[model samples]
Target: MDRPVSKVREAKLELYRKKGNIHAKEVTGRFNTLRWGMVWLTQTIFYGLCWINWESAGSVRQAVLFDIAHEKLYLFGLVLWPQDALLLALVLIIAATALFLVTALAGRLFCGFACPQTVYTSIFTWIEARIEGDHLARLRLDAGPMSLRKLLIKTAKHSLWAIVAIWTAVTFVGYFTPIRELLPTVVALKTGPWEAFWLIFYAAFTYVQAGLAREAVCQHMCPYSRFQGVMFDPATSNVAYDRQRGEPRSNRRQAGQTGDCIDCGICVQVCPTGIDIRDGLQYQCINCGLCIDACDQVMEKIGAPLGLIRFASETALVAPEKHRPWYTRPRIGAYAALLLIFCGMGVWTLEHRSLLLVDVLRDRGALLRETAEGEIENAYTLKLMNLSEVPRDFIVRVAGMPGARIVGEERFTAEPGSIRPVSVTVAAPSDSSLSGIQPMLFSIQAADDRSIEVVEKSSFILP
Candidate 1:
């Protein structure tokens, strides 16, 4: 009996060191509602955007298209060229700044509620619970021998997982290919090589990460889980154990003799990542607050006060006099300021975007020629890009030189979404004042709407 007691104590110590699988009990609260709201909002937008299409005035429709082959990105009314890749860079910076601000202010709120991994894992786990039963039952089912009932349950679960994963992949590819055409092609197994590869790869990734490696993705695969500590401060809120209120834990019967904690270990059981909140913050803690809900339930059942495990800061629970407000935190303020600046830049860039582009290149073979009319003339090739949806007729004109005249037709027609090249001659009288490489402005005004103008600067040479 003495030896068995010693072995039991040793086993308990080992279990304490290594966390067991958390069969997190379901609970309802304000945070849980907020999490579901985010899930609805994000998934709705993601799936909705995949099916939306718009008809442009050009041959091609104005759908969400990233025409990488043509080096163009079309977003609603905006057309971005490769030279404007800075916009993508600015977007990334803004995203980073927003993450920093959120992390400093709320501590892994994004990870817990809005992150794709977390959201998908929640969905996958919900499906698992529906098919395999609750936490204890799921464990039992996994350990039991293979049977027809188990096979049927597993098949249903995996079939649903595959459908969700395939849908996710399809939506991701829709950003590049028109979903209407891509879907039919996918069904026929006739998709382009790159598109087919990406669809399969993304589907496999979703299946493995969400369906199989749920918690392992957070604990071992995600770099964010490892570096989240650097963003943390004493003021940052996290799922923290209130050790002062629940230490020297004992059973519910002897509650007054010890702390409020009954040592029921509900907090440990509910954690999806299988972590013990009572052990203090670990890298695996996503700050999801499922543990808080679990502990709250335990406290209520034992006739004890709640918040034995809660969303709080280490300093707030430990030091009474040094508590600081969230906004006053220096790191959070800096991150917020940066996010605001980038957001402003993005808005400004969108507002001032151009609808057309022009490039004028002077003929290099012969700079200036003496026409039969004995006037000094220069040859130029004008490249006009009609970036708008409507076909536009443009009247070409020259400025910056007095008495400069166009030799031929002054107007040309450009098809919508097409680049047209027109060759024209600019002439000046032999005696007219002109020297080598005189600065000139070639302007094109839309015949339909004079307000839309594209201008390019070039030089006219006089020999």
Candidate 2:
């Protein structure tokens, strides 16, 4: 069902990796700092956006609410209706294309830095380290026998994890239901069945994925990790270890020890995914740069130049001076072009999008009737959807027939963000040049603004 996976080169450290529950040693460096920074940034947006309110049609509503009950997606001043589905599709396409472009240029950069799984996993692990002590201490604790102190500590840790997961789920559901109402309903034990189900389901999902699954999700569950190899090339930059400089690792300072590596295994311990970078670009590697940070610190203390492990392409490592340019790669270039085209199309469509939608349905009761003046009459129903944030009056008009004029009300009103159906009647002389199911056009226009108008095609039947 999924793409083929690349095998990781086996080494003696494979035994260490088999140890249950990888406890990644906390490392401090620019990349670690950047990762935490992303964690804060992403969580802030996810948790805070639902609290913002906007004024719409003389009523206050959530600024970014996806009101599925009303089939409306409100984004600040923009109100998208079902007819604007193309915009949603375009946005998804643009996001996927951008991800592919970024992946082709730098393999798994998103998985490393900004993936929700990685971010939440990092948070959960940090909490674990804080409560259970460092990686070595945790290993010791797990191996030790159960005791009162261990039980208390475990209880506290799981309690906090449940709280975080439950709150995360609540914030996610707030996007669909108004958070203001949903919170009160939840506290009052009055939440709807759907709300209760999602709250419990999402909380469990987050707890298991972030607190328990951890690296297993990235290594085995994520399809992106499985398929990312196809996007990489010899020149694609990724977290890599320089075997030329780091091979023949020696633990002791002795003569003929040309390799810079000291066999400290610090890189392996710091890796969240628990895969050695020296394993030659394994699918399990998330390109998180933690190993690079760990290796650089070791390099500095040992008086060796930094970058034993760094973001270097295979071609760059083999021949630094002859690596191909990113722009020259056909696959990367194609991905970049696709991202631009989709983004441009989305912007253009939104800029020219109309605020009025119209549909015509011929009244089945009387497709054709004769007035007392010997005139053929037709009846139609017009469904007008007003997408604006304010209510306004709309004018109706008919065309595509000679001397065909509206006999009933030509002006009607629609509420803001509501659909209104109106019955319209048209009459034409029986001696008209056209007869028998002639094509007709129905147009609806805003009475206040000529620019807001829509024309739909129907038919006028005649005997």
Candidate 3:
């Protein structure tokens, strides 16, 4: 049976509404140069950090490896365990708060410059431009009929994009798996299931998102672009056109034209999201300032003053007297304060965190027992997790009850980044009148390091 007409019509409408071919024309400016510089710096650190090795706990491992199988994260001199998960949470909060602060001060700064989507899209587009020529050339090529030259260009562009995407995926997964060992398996086509799965999945996603989807990810997929308006205030710095000065626009310079705008349309050509800035700030605008750069170039050539389109606050544009410095804005100040607080807490927690952690669980199967020597005994399990990088012997001692002592083992050793479960028995005189349950303290201290210790509380039951 033929497909339903309604379904086909809906599909056609959806495609037409959502799709727009954006071939952002290349422009040379300080902001564009800075964006490219960030791309180079970030990718260099990402792709290179996995291969860098550091001496860690008598063995060489990746400088920044998240060894999930061992429940350890080796970050240069610092080691993190599952117990330190709070630190990770705090770090995430700090990052998110910082993003909010930046967004409040300058609209979508992260989205425009530092976002992975923007960075990778810029790279893919750069490669595409190199292969297919500039904006006009690319448009012409797409509009023309298929030819051998077009086929060669398209094939070469996709092949290079795949190479970069696959490498990016491998480097990302290398943070979890040992890249040194995983590389050999990848080369031999014998990677484990999870490794192969993530590698292929991420590579395909990068190619599709960066090379094919492009601006659609920033426009529709990213929630930040949609909600950034909530963070925006009148004081937020954004790329805006001076409508009062530039309006009454004309394509040609009449004899008595007053407005500065010449209707050149260069700004729209250079926009990554393909939005006209003159229509005012839109959700699709990334605030990358490329339009400002394009407009400034046109103004300079026409002997007109710069800043016809530039970064300025809405309040400054409307009432210049009400304008204030970015830091003086109450919203920006609040977000900055939150970001600092989160960062400070994370640093303080990491500094004062104990190197040893202990958890005591009283044996419920046989809570209390009478010994032949007329003594009351209790069994407990102590879980000693070492959060340090070096192995050490720990001494377990029980207190808070007179004449109470550990019966069997008091000295135990824990390897680096390992959790050891120690079974212990505490015995006290049966006729001591200590009936019911009594609170006791179990202290585990490192044999060599006095600074490393943990105290846990448990109950001593007597019959």
- Give Cα-based local distance difference scores for all models: 0.80, 0.88, 0.87
Superposed on all Cα atoms, model 1 deviates from the true structure by an RMSD in Å of 3.3
**Please, what is the TM-score per model?**
0.89, 0.94, 0.92
The parts of candidate 3 lying over 4 Å away from their true place are: 1-20, 254-256, 370-374, 430-433
Best by lDDT: 2
* Tens-digit lDDT track of model 1 for 89-204: 88889998888888877788888898999888888888889988987787677768999999999999999999999999998888888788889999999999999999999999
lDDT tens digits by residue: candidate 2, 102-145: 88888998999899999999989988988999988887888789
Whole-structure CA lDDT of model 1: 0.80
lDDT assessment of candidate 3: 0.87
Clashes of 2: 0
Candidate 2 lowest-lDDT run of ten: 1-10
Which residues of candidate 2, in runs, are more than 4 Å off?
1-16, 253-257
Q: Give the TM-score of candidate 1.
A: 0.89
Better candidate by lDDT, 2 or 3: 2
